[model samples]
Target: MDSDEDTFDNDNVDSGNVSSGDDDFAMEVDISSSRERQTEPEEYHYEVLTTDQIVQDMVDSISDVNGVVNLPRTITRILLNHFKWDKEKLMEKYFDGNEDKFFQDAHVVNPFNKPNTISVPKVTKSTTDEICEICFSRNPSGMMTGLECGHRFCKQCWGEYLTTKIMEEGVGQSISCAAHGCDILVDDVTVTKLVPDAKVRVKYQHLITNSFVECNRLLRWCPSADCTYAIKVSYVDARPVVCKCGHTFCFDCGENWHDPVQCRLLKKWLKKCDDDSETSNWIAANTKECPKCNVTIEKDGGCNHMVCKNQNCKHDFCWVCLGSWEPHGSSWYNCNRYDEDEARAARDAQEKLRSSLSRYLHYYNRYMNHMQSLKFENKLYASVKHKMEEMQQHNMSWIEVQFLKKAVDILCQCRQTLMCTYVFAYYLKKNNQSMIFEDNQKDLETATEKLSEYLERDITSENLADIKQKVQDKYRYCEKRRKVLLDHVHEGYEKDWWDYTE
Candidate 1:
């Protein structure tokens, strides 16, 4: 992945006009412009929506269905929930499927074919013999409520039932009526009327919003901590979605937008790194087994001569060749005889384990180095922002100081790209094309490190111009290298030039 360069452009656009604030509308504008300038349009399109916007979208969807079906809003919402908020599917099924069965399946009463259920009378004193199903008390008509299914309960009982479902159970859109064995869903209006406590009602609303986002295939909550925004995409794919909080994630897997390595491979790499079983593999890689008794041994001393301490089998051997120590005679340090089958077999086995460990560490260390480097990116941003302010004090415009921030952005991009490349390289099987990819990785890594160095170097009045030139030059080169690396990787993906090992 390209580290989502376009997603960060909005933060620096027209530097003079930009200010730190809560609004992200400017970001949406910048994204639109960025997409227009691209030679190849992005595979996915998305919108960052707030809570109110999501609610409005739900209302709009309900209105759209109501325009065609002409059902009550409450019943329409139940039908939509049944279809997972898919209007077209709900419409198709409503028109094509048997009407009575459709309403029954959705746990709703058909508004078109209304059944003669007990009518809820107007608010008044308890004059008629109306017994509440829940409390079994003959309460006033005004003190009782229920869904269209007519399983009425006292107001107190309804409030408790809704509170348990919303606050305790976390059930929102699919909360059914309180009547025993009745699966008919309670609609939002009834919930709002019955649940009088503002806190519980608020929680119920949040739960409904969460359900809408989760159930809809086109929507995803931004994965950043404490961010309340959700992304609505035109379609699902492994493309980046930048939330208003500036967290860019992949729409498909909800991970940080990782290019070069696909989602499945990244998942496998994370699992491998997290697995504790690799500790034993490390021991096998670093230590050797006693040739005679099959006990593990570690060489901590300068001498190569070894002896197994298994009391029953006090076997003596040379650590270098795992052969009988007696054969060395006086040439102890220079034992070159490997004609023994046991020694050759032991040597081969040890080397195989060591080679596997060495290969994994090579890629793992580089991957981790880049990841660790990314941790400093936030501190780097703070440093660059201070530098920008200092440059403005030196008779430079805000526009002139903007390059410092831009450099930091590109540097972060390069670091993220380099981090994901190791995950790509680890599973890659060696071939001519793999060698080319390694070359690209090397070029990007070298440029990224130099860029990082320049950013950290001290800036002063005497070296201001020189520092600006160097920082600009380094970041541009780093950007070019990153693009070239990603382009090659993407091309390889299309051409099937790369192969992976287990």
Candidate 2:
């Protein structure tokens, strides 16, 4: 039996095409080479991978490179990391360049061009008198360890150094040798064998895996809070990707799939909001500076006569005309000297400032309203589930009452789309196409509100069928209108029909 608080959750399906059971917002890219235009909206394709899977993929990449280069796995891993896990780029540079120089640039010794030196096993018990470069101690009983560079250090010093680098410094992929001037890197095998503490070892492994994911352009860690999954895409683009955790975000910028508004504009919009720069806009629109002393003043009273509160310059002026009050004398209440060029220009500038502020607030208010509504999505889902149970108790089957849940789902999606539309509209320049886009936004907004209202209405056995039909009709209309708006925006993008102010 499904609980009254059941939410929509699904596992990641491994497929070439992006699919989220009933979610229409999942985007996919068309990889097929056809000059003919397709009718469907563009979508993105990606895979959600677990941490263990990410590690395994890293190992597989190392193995693949090792297969062709015939190098040790440890050396292959370092080379792959140096190239940011790009196998093709690593291969290109490895075969086409000077092998010794390439290895030196990567800070790894070429196993093939090694000078004639004694090959002592790492972490071996010391038999002859040798001073550890790190500790500067010649211990007869302590173990000695070193990399291929042959600068041996006491085993105790190696553990301490590796622990500091891994646990304290957070260095994972490119940790150089413990020797002072040696640039030879310590491989994962040597690190694992040297670091005795289980916690440090695990942290080192995690850091390595995270670095692999972060450095690779094809991968992105899911931005959902507390989610451990990472998404792997074949190519990078500002396309929507859905994680197995049911969180959908843009693979490029990691924001919620904000169609209509491109990633760069959305980034600028977010920065503007976070900076709270609109408060200064409001100040500029509402308040004026004193003409004489230039002291900033806000008119709190309704009187047109204004006095500069500055101690040095107590100049009297008219608030509306910003003209000297001495011209009016006792007729200050009806100052007709408003046509002066200076005052006219001042008023014009203030009007322009107010208009700009009004435009920003218009879009910002709508965007924030939808964002606020989406925060209650879980409550809406729970309310719909309860209604579903009530309908079930009134002789309706469990499947029959699913329309309520589906309507809520569509309502939430509509809200998200609506939120992004305002962002798109905020930057859009006024034109015939923009007018049509606004009309589309209006239609979608109307249908979404109707659907949301229908979902929140109390359901009873008396009007179950009637409400069911109405809810279904409204949600279908909402979904249809949403698609229309998005499709128009996509068309605008392709045909260069839309223009931005910034």
Candidate 3:
């Protein structure tokens, strides 16, 4: 997962070129950038975060809210939670309205008014000795917590309620008062004072600390299972952002970043791939070997009378009936029609559309197959590491074999991007204008497989230098063709030059 070695803080929006030989589709875009970030062909971006930094961002956001609202930071936090952390909308709607309703609803009744001293609630002596409102047990008024709703409950009852809300569920959960019908949100400070377990309070702190990132639209916690690091991007039409943890993902869809392809089209293609339509296409496009040389021959043009072009073993045969040309008695064309076995599975007009889809699957299946090849190619890193260690035994510095890993990673990324571009091309929607794209795709596929083959072969000390140069050369060639393909597709998408039908 080596991305361009850029820091997360460096989100400078910049422009780049995507040029095909004589064609160009120009558009403006913002991409992640940093100075001298990508040192080699196959690396990406990452940014790690510290707990202190995360907490500071939270504090800063709250402080900003407090400054604008002219309230204490704690009150601002409570108001933020009340509105699900949307400060601007909350202010626009309720800033000058009945402000006390928010404090009362949140149960964050201000102990101080204007400033100066704490305002204490008037405690009645009779109420202290009277029945405890919730548990029906007698308790001193000081031992009971009272919300602004005037509902008094024993500390034990409040503690159990808070535990149930925060511990039985997630710590950030908010619940109402214990008084039968009171819906006022019980404040966290009250929950902390009542709960006996110290660990539960720790969870509350953790929740509040990360709440800023969790609640913001522009920010998201990295999707990595063990990593809680969060990333932030401006809430605009942003491209994918790479995490410090080597997780690259799209800011818009929150899925893996698919550049040079539309998210909508990618979604449709994935769902299409999930169905068996493409799988069936692979079967119908099947090929049979030439009669003499055993070379697999696929029918491309019309007429069943086919001749093998393999110079050493040219053989004439019928494309449909699949036998020697002499078997047709020199004039019979019934072989052009479906034989009994073929007629059983024959579809008439519907088969025409099916054949079109099968044509798409011809490209798509290879795209996906190469994508799988890229994954296995990435695993080759481990194998390359072992080879490097083995080479070190011969007094060759580990640096000598390091080139192998770099070349492989570059090839994998290029091939993957290459594979996804076919999906883009298939859905480009401009059927009449894709001849050049197909040419680029065929060129890329050839160079890509050539590079893959070179890297995938066994590497020993004997052919290390020779194979390294071959991988370098093939990878450069593959990378060039890959870029040409994607550039053509990305330009088509950006400029909307191709009329996307689906």
Error of 2 at 430 (Å): 1.3
Candidate 3 regions exceeding 4 Å error are 1-48, 82-87, 94-127, 130-134, 171-173, 209-211, 235-237, 267-371, 391-396
User: What C-alpha lDDT values do all the predictions have?
Assistant: 0.77, 0.78, 0.61
Give the alpha carbon lDDT tens digit for every residue of 1-502 in model 2: 0112211112221111223333322111111111011113554567889776877788788778878988877788788889999999999999986999899988988888875444343332555556666677775533676777776777889989999998889888879988777788988778767788977777777778778888899999888666688999999988777776667778899998787689999999999888868888988999999999988899999987899999999999988888887776675444555667888898999999999999988888999999998777546866666777888889889888777766776777788889999999999999998999999999999988887777777887787888999999998898889888888998899999988898
Instruction: For candidate 1, write residues 269-362 as lDDT tens digits.
Output: 8888999757877989777777778898888888877888889778888888877778677756445657667677778888998898888888
- Candidate 3 achieves a global lDDT of 0.61
Q: Judge candidate 3 at residue 465 and give its lDDT.
A: 74
Per-residue lDDT, model 3, residue 132, is 57
Model 3: lDDT of residue 111: 39
Tell me the TM-score of each prediction against the true structure: 0.76, 0.81, 0.67
* Residue pairs with backbone overlap in model 2: 27-43, 27-44, 28-43, 28-44, 29-43
Ten-residue segment with the worst summed lDDT in candidate 3?
22-31
Q: Given candidate 3, what's the lDDT at residue 74?
A: 51
